[model samples]
Target: MDEARDYIRAMGGGLLIGLPLLFTQEVWQHAVLLPAWKILLLLGLAAIVVIGYNAINGFRADATIGEVVVDSVEAMGIGTIVAFVALLALGRIDGGSSVRDIVGHVALESIPIAFGASLSRAQLSGAGDDEGREEDRRGGQTKSESEAGRLGPFQRLLVAAGGALLFALNVAPTEEPVFIGVGASPVMLLGVMALSLVVTLALVFFAEFGGRRHVSQGILDRPIPETIAAYVISLLVAWTLLWSFGRVDGASVVAITGMVVSLGLVASLGAAVGRLLVASGGEREDG
Candidate 1:
């Protein structure tokens, strides 16, 4: 049936087109694809990127299902590749770095890691794009606040670090976070904040450039939306890097890392639910 064919295209777009490109690093990391530990970790990271891309496309539910998948795959793939290229460009890791080293450094060892930087931009950008589309769909939504692509390094760090810290401390309200209430010194917290700032900015720049290339080539559904998705994908993919290095400073940093890990779990769960709804023919409110 034509409908079945369409679904095939959608799955194909995401699985075939996106997976290979997004996991070139993974392929290099595990050419053998043996032992569960070897391929599973990297593949898992790639899976998150795939789902993150879908979430971005989910914002544009009016688009055809197959079309959305294709766009999502393209966006995610661009994000994964460019984040690495950014690492190299930034000289944090050389192209010559072993696959494991590059994966460890870029995805898990870096300060904010690629995920926080990319996701912060994506969230801001998604909010704008969603707001814009909602306005056009409703024909009554405000245009004053729907501007897209305005996320910057400082803002991303604030969102990721502040959000992570706030979420973490909120989970277990203790004297630690509340010390700020007493105007306590924040030397350690400030360091984590600074590290997050540096990591997030680098990811944003490279990922954005790669996403833009797809937009220019007419490979994506839309520039703004795809860019947002790419950013989210970058965030999810970079989780490994964030976790690997996050605890080097001790308790406070580890706590913040735990918060981010928790948040990633929540975000991933939401993505799965969204996919299920879409498969069930649920129309998105914004779209």
Candidate 2:
């Protein structure tokens, strides 16, 4: 019974995150135009991300890699079902649509939704406090507060990647990045990058956004190097997402850089939030 309720909550979260995209004309258009290979790649990438997220922040107690993988697959299934139903109800997909079109559109739409489902325990449940205490006990930590600073670099990077991908997924299919790129000068783009870095630093290091508990002491004490590394990762994620959505194809080098910069700002914010989430054992909001 509890398991069923949890799955229901996860589905609800999936709908909350995915319904808007189901109705988006741009999303539909992208589904139609994006090549099959790209769609396949996106699905595979989403599975990997879901698995990484589950391994770090999922619901199972002392979950092994195999358990995490199973949970990730289940989350993907929930996301796909939610996306398909929403698309069908909204009249965005019809019986007339080809199998490839239906599959592509649903697959792309499911990535973020699946992510939200995978994150439902953290975002929608009140059990995080209990889980944290349990973890502290298992780790032989006498102080509950000190447990937050122990996450390794690899875990932090995975969280950052998850956050970057979640944020970039929404914007990658839109024209906003390209529009901003067209209007902004090189100096303006540089300013944007600087702002992204500053915001990321503030959120992860200075902001009291419930993440201080999980923050690494090394990062909290000397944050510059880690912040720079995370910012670079965010840019790489943004660029990859843009490419996956066909946003960078045929664009000039300068234009591609601008689009990446524009998108990187948002992706960096997501990365900051992700770092905190991972640190907090995935108890924070998805952002």
Candidate 3:
């Protein structure tokens, strides 16, 4: 049951994630040209992506079905990884004491990998999803206060270490881009940021609609708290892979904040739309 759920979540994210680099231009175009339409459409898409992501991980918000969650909640971790990689590649990955850069980076750079991250989430989660969550439930481990009994000792240690590293990086990022071939350019930097926003909007709508419709009412007699589990698992995956691979030239907190907000609103709208569509579709069949 757990494995099935995990596979389903990752598969859904992969399918929903748009073609790599395809939406990057669109993100930039829409942000400047059609802010209103882009915002609305983006919100719808983001909502669906998040909703579908959560459902695939597990219909409940407190269970661990896979290594990653397609929802925005887990996407936070994915975004972290992508931003890390983006800045690393940009030769300017910074995690300075300011929360502003974190938000900026998320908005502009994170969009490109939003879908890819979602798609790759499954691979990252793998077996860890089951064993870690299972142990935490049985009182076999203790993580942070926020995590509670969600991860085992080793996993918790890993997350803590990863967070610590992020804190250190925020103080001062190393002068190295993870991807060797990637270059730095002021214009292209803005382009990347724009692209990230566009992609995030797309994700919002997709996540929202998919999550609500697929899960439908009365589907689960008692869905576990899949949300929490999925979120926690994704954190581990993000820390391990995305963070390691994330590379970018320049970082900005305002940008990431804008992207996250844009993504979240759209996701909610998409989810509502998905539910409405599913309900209508069922009604039509019945009639």
Candidate 4:
């Protein structure tokens, strides 16, 4: 009964985060057109993310490695079922669709949904207090907390990159980035970049969004340096994703840079959220 309840909550959380993409026309298009290798790679990457998330903030506390693995698989399964059912209900998946089409579409869309499912405990359950108390009783920081503090510069870059990728993937296939780039002047673009940096800093270091905590008290936790570093990472991720989607294939350097900056705004916001999500626990005062 407990397990069933958790699954139901996870499905609900998945739907909350995944519904927009599930109905997105570009996402559906990508489902049918993305290459097999890309699809497979996405699935593998999703598994790793789900497992890593489960290890820290999963529904089950102190979950063993084997248990985290099982839960990750189960979350993916739940995400798949939810995606198929929603698509079918919306008439997006008709009976006339081929097996390959149906499978590919559901499989591709399931990755994000599954990731949301894996995050249900942290995002949906409102159980952080209990979990924090448990960690305190254990007499030291949990494994996730410990590791978050010890992350090197490269790891911080990777965290920002992953966040940018996850968020950028949602809108990259759409025309919004292109449209934004086309309409904005150079001055406007510069304003947008400044705004993105300010917002990223506020959210990650200054703002109190749900009493969330920072992972480390190191140099990266400082507003100026972390903001600069994360913004750079976001730009890199935006550039790479844009290139991969062929959005900048024949574009001029200025055009490409503008598109990357436009998308980097969104990616920076995502990086902030990602930092909060992966940081393991709530704010702690210096003792």
Candidate 5:
């Protein structure tokens, strides 16, 4: 059960951190333009980072050198799978694509995802509060629950907005969302909105991350409503960024809505994960 939870946390963390990059056009272009040798070198560097991270603060306590190596490989594998699926979903790579192209795309996107996976437990699983989490899993009150007051509604909204901005800031200024929006049909764009809400709910409620124990259940705090509210906040943040970046000026309503929804997918995930990390007391300032 513990191992399953760890794997889930790793995957959730990877998606939360790596999803934005999948929407990045530059990454797609790099996958196509960079040579195989360069890809291999990038993969090598990613490996080193993953291994070093696992050696210091892996999912398992007191893991040996061999265990660290195995964990690193596992992280990379998870990341590669995530990149592959996301790329396929985004229509960045299709069956007609050559094996080399697919491999290149997956490898490039997997690096940051693998980094997220490698640090998943340390960053998202409340490493500093293991005892509390264990107690939480056993249905006991958590440290955060006992010590910290639940975040109010306004605070939750603010955190969601801030997180949405952090996630969408770079993507909002780019043309990828516009390109995707213009190409997609209205139905497809609505699918994007649906997907955003689904992913956000999964990340915050169903992923079973450690911080979940601290999520408040006040007004508009139930899973479905909270998810919807966060998504709305994300869309608003997306619109603000798009407008400020001049990406939406003089655009059709359909086009603007599509862009907002495209960016909202990642923005919603950011809001959900950020609430877990920040509001639930999983995050700590580094000295």
Candidate 6:
């Protein structure tokens, strides 16, 4: 059960950070354009980053060198699979795609995904650092006291906006959202919106991530309502980013809505994880 949960979290983290880049056309082109040596170099760099990150903040609290290497390899594998599947779902690659194109696309995109997987325990979970929280407990801080340090409702919304922007900003300016929005049917857009909300709720509440104790201490704290509120923030942020990027300019309402929903999928995940991060940090400071 524990290992299953860990793998799920790792997959979630990879998607959370990697989905934006999957939508990028430049990334798709990079796969075929870069020389083999450069591609190998990029892979090496990604491996080094994953290995170093595991050495520092891996899923386990205490991992030996062998363990870290194993963890890094697993993260890389998970990331590669995530990239391949996501690209396929987005229709970026297909059965018709050449071997070089497929390999380049998957390998290039997996770097960030693996990095995100490696940071799973730190970034995706609502839980904070285990050792730090344990130290706080030993320091005589009560649970209620820790909860009191959580961001207020308004503060959480603001942080959610910031997080949404952080994740969606780069992708928003690109052509992918427009391409997706224009091509997708109304049903597809609705599906995207639904998935975005589900992802948000899962990350913020159901993931059993660390620092969850500090999540819902504010006035508007119920799970469903709060998730709705965060989703709203993500949508608003997505709309704003699209408008600013001129992607929505002179567009029909249907097209605009599609674009917003497509980008909101990424932004909503950011909002969910962002609230957790800030809540954890605030608790630690108060403790």
Candidate with top TM-score is 2
Poorest 10 consecutive residues by lDDT, candidate 3: 166-175
Q: Candidate 6: where is the Cα deviation over 4 Å?
A: 1-137, 141-149, 214-219, 281-287
Measured on C-alpha atoms, candidate 4 has an lDDT of 0.73
TM-score of each: 0.32, 0.87, 0.28, 0.80, 0.50, 0.51
Higher-scoring candidate on TM-score, 3 or 4: 4
Q: What's the count of clashing pairs in each model shown? A: 7, 1, 74, 0, 0, 6
lDDT winner among the candidates? 2
- Candidate 3: tens digits of C-alpha lDDT, residues 82-183: 555555555443544234444444343344344334434532453245345655534532222123222232332233222222222221112222221134
- TM-score of predicted structure 5: 0.50
Q: For model 1, what is the error of residue 194's alpha carbon versus the real structure, in angstroms, after optimal superposition?
A: 26
- Please tell me which model should have the higher TM-score, number 4 or number 6: 4
Give the alpha carbon lDDT tens digit for every residue of 25-90 in model 5: 877776777678867865774576466546544322556788888888889999999989989999
Q: Which stretches of candidate 5 lie over 4 Å from their true place?
A: 1-145, 214-217, 282-287
Better of 5 and 6 by TM-score: 6
Q: What ranking emerges by lDDT with the best candidate at the front?
A: 2, 4, 6, 5, 1, 3
lDDT of model 2 at residue 172?
A: 78
Q: What overall lDDT goes with each candidate model?
A: 0.36, 0.78, 0.35, 0.73, 0.72, 0.73
Tell me the deviation in Å of residue 235 in model 6: 0.8
In the range 47-123, model 6's lDDT, one tens digit per residue, is 76467555543322446788888889999999999999998999888999989888888987886688678668444
Residue-level error in angstroms, candidate 6, position 2: 38
**Residue 111, candidate 5: C-alpha displacement in angstroms:** 24
Tens digit per residue, CA lDDT, model 4, 98-205: 887798788877877887787774555644544556757347654444444444545555556657767887887788998887678899999999999999888877
Q: What is residue 32's positional error in candidate 4, in angstroms?
A: 1.6
- Candidate 5 global lDDT: 0.72
Candidate 6 achieves a global lDDT of 0.73
On the 0 to 100 scale, the lDDT of residue 257 in model 4 is 78
